[model samples]
Target chain A: MSRETILASIRAALPPGQALPELDNFGLHYDDPIQQFITTAEAVGANLQSVDNRGGIAAAVQAFLPGASSILSHVPEVPCKNFTRDADRDPHAYSDLDLIVVEGLIPVAENAAIWVPDSQYDDHAAMVLTQHQVIIVRASDLVDHMHQAYAKVAAAEVPRFGFFLSGPTKTADIEQSLVLGAQGTRSLLIIMIRDESTSTI
Target chain B: MIDHAQHARNFTANAERTAWHDDALWFVREKRDKATKLIPEWEELREQASQVKMHMLSRLDHYLEEFERNATARGIQVHWAEDADAHNRIVHAILERKGVKNIVKSKSMLTEECHLNPYLAERGMDVIDTDLGERIVQMRNEPPSHLVMPAIHIKKAEIGDLFHEQLGTDAGADDPKYLTEAARQHLRPKYLEADAGITGVNFAIADTGGIVVCTNEGNADLGTSLPPIQIHCMGMEKLLPRLEHLGVFTRLLARSATGQPITTFTSHFHGPKPGGEMHVVIVNNGRSAILAKPEFRRSLSCIRCAACLNTCPIYRRSGGYSYGSVVPGPIGSVLSPAMDLEKYAALPFASTLCGSCTDVCPVKIDLHDQLLAWRKYVVKEGYLDKGKARQMKMAGKLLSSPTLYRTASFLSKGMKLVPRVLLYNKKNKWGMERELPLPAKRRFRDLYRKRPRS
Candidate 1:
């Protein structure tokens, strides 16, 4: 078997063992994580908004993207035209999706990335296929850096699919000119909810 | 024979484009400096990352088995390839069994190394490269010049023309935003219609038996999410011992590659989506051989950030095509020679040994030192050119004897009286693009002997 052959080669080529360094307390940590998160989110071209409660999320989304027509909301606090979760439905049907609103599990302050596991939505394609995205993150769930973020991820049940999304899809392929919305979400809006509450609608 | 100097000469012939390319890459290197400065523990992070890789390399076999076991337990089919041909065949066999015709691939240097696109294309597969830069180069029938910015060599006007011809965009429309939107619209359908999605693994976690792929465009996410079959191709060195190691790499990768805090998306796949199938192909295409060499094995720690390429003066001024390899620049110069010493013997000499690539490397690979090491190996193996060997041999003999060196230094002063034509003739390769400094009126030894005591 090629597997055995490759393993034998790797074993034969092994060098003397070196100790793995301690990773604890080694990475960067921000003084004020929330503010740092806000600053980094904007730097990467993602819009940020703060809401007093979950009830206010829908209004904020409406105010920011009033022109969005085909919206899909995975969060119950924000209702949209499409809320169906049909496993049999083709993921290709979301190519025309204008907006997708899903709740973020954890937010990293250093890079302004939000961890969204598979449990957050029915179809993972909805997050990227849409023209715009609104990820709802709790203000208190913010961490200082990726090291802390991974600690939380490792402690939880491993999802089949999870991602750390920092900003909207972007590219600088042509002449290194920064262009937003290359092959995924063109615009991303992060709505941080400060208080938990039921949907107003 | 691949003469890197000759190819570099052809690239640098266009003085205007060369300057633009140099400035463009330097701008990225500057951004990297600024981004890394924001982290107070940047140096410490680099040290930790280096140690982690060295430790991983020492016990790579144990970790690979652990990763395969965990990945297999999660329902991901793990396959191993002895070389590039075996890798291509494994992927093709999977597609053939599934009757897959259309495929979408994101940025995968491994696939490029294996030349998988052409292999599948010859079998009548409609393979589409989804990354915007990759797509542009794919349409042009060209290889990526730089790893991070594949189409960096092509100007915006050229891209506008390419889009106009291939995707029916309006001619003379060179705005990056407009061109990028055209690509987004054009590729959305391909993602939807693709029978399989193929992506490159950024990091494979042994602890979780999952793979992490980072992308600025989220092309990998969309490409894999929509398709029923997803194939991830990874070089064996991509493995990490645990999940937390990702934090160390993710923090360094984007900040090093394009100066972002992180890529737009860092997607982790532990297993196939419900009712879907996933396969992981572990390739050993010349990597185990690299591991066998203790002096050069540290080069395996490269995270493909391309920081070394951006900082390399030779890579910036001469352009990536000069190296004539899948990867170009300082890291490529060291790695290519290992593949074939005869073919890539000229690569090590392409550098100025500036050590800037070493200073900026996140994993702390001694890139310039490796280049210097490769030069010795090349000479020892008798690959060094005869003319250069003769010149070095004479220089060695002169420097060994004090009387001969002093006498030669004294005679060199009379050469200044010679005409410019005599000094700058075809036989003087060093004088081709340079001028000799005026020889000192008196030898340094003579001047030192006449100096007053302090």
Candidate 2:
């Protein structure tokens, strides 16, 4: 079915009021909220310029796409995953412009290191990320964040320890005391872009 | 009973616990990928397993009958439950016959679906969950957020607290190893003393008239091996045509569900350990309803692999409990509404329709598309609120014609003050969070006109 019909059918299928409070207009997302919520949340604010990695939105974003890896990171170490310009990406979903930057390009300074949960390989990505703000999220930490982000938005409210994931990480080798974030990034990094655009001030 | 909105709020909170939850599960997902990548037949395996499930779903009633017949010949008593209440009572009645007040249960989503423990508790029976994760959640007085990993939402520190309070651990003793030993010591006695064991069927073989239970920790083995009376609760959809399908399914099941090369254990029980009593309850709460409809028939194809749950973006953000169903996440979003639309109507809309769940599913349930179809059913039932219905009808009328749509757009964008009251309908989700952005002066088509075509 067409996106409109799929949405119409879904909207039609909802038991009314249950579709509670949706984006004013549904475009490509099939009127699904999870996408709208996450991608939009990720959109945060665009850089005033083209810079997506560091400088300005214009220069940064441009450097990150279309033979993105071909454009070297301002930081030398962080490995840049090949970037593709996904113009069709839903604003509510993670954009196609994911750049797996080298881990060590910018290291977490002593004071701010506390906030960022460490990434799995600290020493390897360490050199490239020192100057830049870094979030060392582990596989487990990402899961926790996803849980927290969904809960944070959906409830239209937030709760403490809201992002902790409980189950899959728990091992019953001896007895099953579930440990979350054990094998993952324990801290998150909020990289402060020098040239602000849409990001929180 | 909570309102759908409140339950939805709770679900959102629970589901958020899963956003990273999906990412976390992705390791296992990645692991499955790593394993699948090595083999050229990975996609083929998914197809064969899906077809097996398709055949089973189509003739669920028939295979179930065959299972009952074979199991009965093997000296097992079979019961059927039409709903949760019936399912619970069947177990209760069996326990009452055995005069057992306590029982051990191994990882059964069906029991969770039935709410068996709480139901039995009210009737004076103490139902103990034997699966390690289930045990932890039960001790904490919380529902299992994820089916396979019962205590996934619980942290080790929190578990330390739970164990400290219940099992007498030192305060702040948060070692996973130490805590597990404590639980093992605690549950061992319960395993030996329990009168009956309840296990969920991972796969039930119709030909052998046997039931299979898969687990990593071997909790199900202890539950069934020790208990004199074993009660296996299975959904009608858990059947496989022949026993050989086990090799393919067993290969994919754990790998897909938990990223393990194989679940630590896969045990098949023909019926009663020689002399013990065996009972199988094939519950069909809403399978028939879904099967009757073509769009949703494929949902029954799910192997409960949870690959969809692990990969779903919405499920990742929101943990399972937010769903307010025995099973949560993408699978529950579709099935819950199918089982009870009034109760779960909001679920389908909870998704962004990313199609990730469909992609990860080994059985290929077409979850996103079914959700799209279900949306039509919910609306066609006229269950919509009149005011919103009127609003939608008005919007529909305007959008049906381009000229009217343009006029409405121009007025909203150009007028600036169309009365937030009128332009920003507070009752809508748009107004609930942020005001809708006014339209740009020109449309994309107009912009295309300005710039030469590529």
- What lDDT score is found at residue B364 in candidate 2? 75
User: Each candidate: what lDDT?
Assistant: 0.91, 0.58
Q: What share of the true interface contacts does each candidate keep?
A: 0.92, 0.02
Query: What stretches of model 1 exceed 4 Å from their correct place?
Result: A195-201
Report RMSD for candidate 1.
1.7
Query: What is every candidate's alpha-carbon RMSD to the true fold?
Result: 1.7, 21.6
> TM-score for model 2?
0.65
Clashes of each: 0, 82
Highest TM-score among the candidates is held by which one?
1
> What's the iRMSD of model 1?
0.7
The DockQ of each candidate is: 0.89, 0.02
Residue B115 lDDT (model 1): 97
Give the candidate number with the greatest DockQ. Answer: 1
Every prediction: chain A TM-score:
0.93, 0.19
| Per-residue lDDT of candidate 1, residues B1-454 (tens digit) | 4788888889889999999999999999999999999988998899989999999999999999999999999999999999999999999999999999999999999999899999999999989999999999999999989989999899999999999999999999999999998998899889988999999999999989999999999999998999899999999999999998888999999999989999999999999988899999999999999999989999999999999999988999988888888889999999989988999999999999999999999999999999999999999999997777887888899999999998989889898888999888767666777888988888898899999998
